[model samples]
Target chain A: MANQPSIHAGVRALARLKKRRRSEAIFRAFGIAAIVFAMCALAWLLGSIIGTGYKAFYQHSLTLEVELTESILAPNGSRDPDTLRRANYRRIMQEAMFTRFPDIEGLSSADQRAAKRQNFDIMSTSGGPNYIRQMVFKDPAMVGQTITVRIPTSDIVDQYLKGNLNVDVPEVQRKISDRQIAWVKTLRQSGEIKAGFNKRLLFSTDSRDPELAGIASSFVGSLMTMFVTFLLAFPVGVGAAIWLDEFAPKNKAVDFIEININNLAAVPSIVFGLLGLAVLLNWAGMPRSAPIVGGIVLALRTFPTIIIATRSALRAVPPSIRDGALSVGASHVQAVFHHKLPMAAPGILTGSIIGMAQALGETAPLLMIGMVAFLTEIPSSLTEPATALPVQIYLWSDSAEQAWSERTSAAIIILLMVLVTMNGIAIWLRSRLEKRW
Target chain B: MTENTSKNIKFTCRDVRVSYSGKEAVKGIDIEIADRSVTAFIGPSGCGKSSFLRVFNRMNDTIPGCAVTGDIRMDGEDIYAPGLDPVLLRARVGMVFQKPNPFPKSIYDNVAYGPRIHGLAESKADLDEIVHNSLKRAGLWDEVKDRLKDSGTGLSGGQQQRLVIARAIAVSPEVILMDEPASALDPIATAKLEVLIEELKEKFCIVIVTHSMAQAARISQKTAFFHMGDLVEYDETDQIFTNPAELRTQDYIMGRTG
Candidate 1:
């Protein structure tokens, strides 16, 4: 009976081990599922952004050949460049549309005007007029000449080409009417309608017309703001970090400062915006809506991040390293600068770059400082009015247009690309500076 | 113990006590370290043997909240004098740690670090010669001569330890302090290092702390026994191993107690 009880205890122990092993396997599966789920979520987000945004990079346009008759443009019959410059370019484009659709020309005068207006609406709001003005400015000699040019189509037609405006939908519910769809089809069949690289959308500033809008101004703004943020944050952040980490004594005041600095990093970013408004704009008398102010505000927000990163980097340097240098007769300053700082450099630089990237995406603080203004020109200096890429994306996303949605997603793609590139550089730099010991 | 050795004293300590954060680590002790000899301190763990060795070079000064008392003089000069700079003092008394802590640099740079900081060498050629001689003295010159540009950390543990020794000697210090220098080495490397230490004693005052009684008896000229932060006994290596003066020292050396 004693031997039997011992054998039974052995079986019970084996059963308990089996139960533990099963739970371990289940935990392993859960971990793998969690990782797969995270990866799938990220992939899904990228997939959707790419799918919708790629269409914005290329736009549909209708190519046409039309006579720029002097009667509609320079009605005075004088080829004076000034008069040509002052000519009615929109009417010339309308006449070109009428020429393309001669059926509209055969209609009665009032009906003809209506048909002409409808045809003109099919062209891009700014591309047709802007193209005429550019040609006239480039060559006054082409006033009476017939030139073939490609002009952007309207957003509704652009949507139709991208299959966003469904033809299967009821005509009343659709942005494009049946007749307009038939005209688009005819143009497509005749090889006149084509998809062209959207140079205007890439080059132009913010516009009410989605087809004419671009992020050029905001890209420059982000560059300038981030530059200023870097200039302010890097030296000050690193200096403060070095002092606090290396020189500060372990007193209650220093301890309190360290705690507050960490807490500052976790504070809501919008609170920084309010502080910037009160300090930089209201009290300091700095210009509002300027990149300089935006940069300062962003620096304040990113300073804590850089400091935290730098202190950790400094801490990672082994105390044995300082001991080695000091043991070799190097002074405290010499040991830190010659050995400790160099060893800690890669980590510091990586942290600074990450902080800069975070500053690049910040928008709420800029909004409080009036960077949400509809800036049309690219900023050339720190003191100029500017808007960042994320703010531009925000502005476009708020517009009530089908094409604006695509542009919004496209801007998001660019932001993500820049962020990825920055992080890649940080990783590369870290590896380059990595030491085995 | 020796009839022909010079009567020069390299270090003299009187009532030296060291404490960390108000906890006394090394109780009051008095000792004199002779010039041009290897003096070893042997004790059990937490006996403050390493702390006592660090007093010679003022290496204990680096630890925060570590307070040192009493008088420690090197070559008739008070090390804790008001006008003395620790940096210059360290150059005079170089140190090698328990673990080999070579900088994350090439072998040549690791040795050149001390000479460069002290400005001991005037030109590149002088620095090169110093590095060569130091490595030679450490018995590491031949193995690393072809690969001086390789990282110091890339070497084997024993090689790295010898490299650290070479780095310490490059500063041309009068006294070199080593803390458990051979505790991490294998039998062959330990034998090689013990031989190097004996040879180094001809030119520099060497103070070493060790855990191995045999190691102390083999290389050191004099051995000091410590227990619980107090010096139990100190004498010539032969007398301490064969005929200890204290009961605790005899018990420790006989492996009867610690």
Candidate 2:
């Protein structure tokens, strides 16, 4: 110990002083600063999203009272074929609103005459109103009828309510008249003009306009895609993993397969999308925008992750357990599934959930497969055109309107919530399985 | 495989050779394990004692790239015959590992697993009885009576080892192969297992592999000494412990050494 260099060695001591404390402290400070910077950025993004998206929960609409007639809906009443189709939803919708709000039945003669208004309600749907569009266009008399309609306010009106409008706002640029503003106040006092939950937002058909768009059309698409991924990926992934981990002999072929699977798991999602488009959508001639095609794409992406996690779990089972099972008359399959697999369940389930969540939130591959199409109606089948939440967020975000920006942030919040929920479920399952230990 | 076959016939091996990927881990050998007796193989590290024990039930088949050849028979029938099902063979000959490998399951479930798989229990109540008797034979029932549903892995190391033995016995196998079953146990646990092994030999043939020469000398009626893939000596445990024949066995006994 005495042979070691002392602190009194002039230039060396100064260098040691700098090395011993300052450099390490500086590095630690840098690390802490980086962490704080990252946290701040995340907080800012979340804060702004929450602030803007909270407005999407409420919407502005105009309500008017007018009579609805059968001729407006079933024009030329002799049509047995058109009635066989779904009822004319638009004519029925106006009739329903008029029945609820009877004050708008008479025409206004003077400018000062106050018209009755109510908080408007509509079974708002998404892209291309399926039954309503067919009904409205089918009847010519429906166009000139004075039936009351509860219509979605424009983006400029929506902005005004969200506090984007000010007192200094120009008269020409203003979306609503002073009378319209007075009616909005009257509706507000009557408990009709405020923001409320948009229930159909997640399950309705698309509207031609953004005012009517909802996530429902896309939710069904996501469900179909996820179902496909679950059906295809779970069995194939787990089986391949069990065979590889428990039965297959140690060989170069298996080694190659393992490496390939690992690499496949890391392949970019967009690359998978392109593959799906070229192979599934074009060559195989599957439905262009079907959720089935989206599922196939996601399954290809999800399998590698499931296989890796499953293999590792199987490997974690002790050799003695295998030997014990074998010695007790359990076949390799019985041993793996009945004995070893039961032990590895927690891990396998965790992997499955992670894979499912990834598939659920995925967008790029779905986009490539045409799941990004502007679908307005709830998906009735796996082969139908639809969009997913993330893609909807992308669609909303790319729009010129600032209102859609808020909607996009709201969609992101929804997606994040879904992800967190799935992860929570996985954790719960893992803990349940781990209780054996 | 015939109906007239004797259940009590002992194992008779001739020129058995075991290899892993072309490397001879156990050289050609001859051995005979008597029925209903405690036969132990004793050797130093890497001397193939555990490998030889695995050969009895073809437990080596579980290992990738491992192969076994030569004759091994029980009840005057070739146990290694071509049509022999490894699963059925294992059912007849059970094993306990060096470390306590109680399944990550309840104590009751652990014992019931083997019987359930073999269809030995005809009903839920019968299954309960099998679990009870197996645990009783392993000498662990009274200690774990209050918590039969608790995980088997929750027991002390000695208790877990006993639970494993209980699981092995639940299937009513004809033979039980123990490979260093108490190697990881403390002195008191080792003594407990040794006494348990003695009691088990009454109903089933007990073959054990051990690194402790003193343990082999203490528990086994016959001891086979293996050295570097070779069976150097086989004799009564007393004789081998007292007066081994081969130079290697003699040197091993005299501590010249392993």
In candidate 2 chain B, what residue range of length 10 has the lowest lDDT sum? B1-10
DockQ of 2: 0.55
Docking class of 1: high
lDDT of 1 at A225: 90
lDDT of 1 by residue, A294-398 (tens): 888899888999999999999999898888888889988888899888998999999999999999999898889888878777778888788999999989999
Off by over 4 Å in 1: A1-9, A77-85, B1-3
Model 2, stretches more than 4 Å misplaced?
A1-37, A61-152, A166-192, B1-9, B254-256
Candidate 2: deviation at residue A388, Å? 2.0
List the pairs of residues colliding in candidate 1. none
Q: How do the residues A71-100 of candidate 2 rate in per-residue lDDT, one tens digit apiece?
A: 654556644545525445544554544465
lDDT of 1: 0.88
